[model samples]
Target: MHRPLPTFRVNGAAIRTIRMSAGLSTSETAERAGISRRYLNHLENGYRDRMRPGRYAALRTALGLNPDDQRLLARLPHEEPD
Candidate 1:
């Protein structure tokens, strides 16, 4: 049996706040996170509410989130494997 994929519910506003506080631009953060700027923009604008666990972790790392902030932003759930 395949393991379920980890899904994360992200907080767009919180991400934008953290990025702005860190003095990082969308392009910079996206580059650091290895995601496209448009995708990051979608995330920041709340267009996308769900993300894979790996992507969420990369975004958190790119934003340099503190432990508390990371915990606040991360909500992971498992999805059944196809």
Candidate 2:
């Protein structure tokens, strides 16, 4: 049997925590991350589960995540579709 590819999930709580700790408003964060405010809201609210790699990289860079934060973000659990 062929193994399924691992799909990574976005940890909204982590993103929200980082945004709050950085004292950034949703608009500010979204602008810095090069994404729309609506999308950011979805991510922060846990409505969205996955993100493109480029977007993820932009988000990480925008948030100025440290090594630990990056690791935590990477470790977020993902759900595999049936």
Q: Tens digits of per-residue lDDT for model 1 on 1-82?
A: 9997877777788788888999999999999999999999998898987789788878888888744565425344553244
Candidate with best TM-score: 1
Clashing pairs in 2: none
Query: lDDT of all the models against the reference?
Result: 0.81, 0.77
Model 2 lDDT per residue over 1-82, tens place: 9986554567788888888898998899899989999998998887886787778878888888853455325352353234
Candidate 2 vs. true structure, TM-score: 0.73
Candidate 1 backbone collisions, by pair = none
Model 2 residue runs over 4 Å out of place are 1-7, 66-68, 71-82
List all candidate RMSDs to the true structure.
Answer: 6.8, 5.9
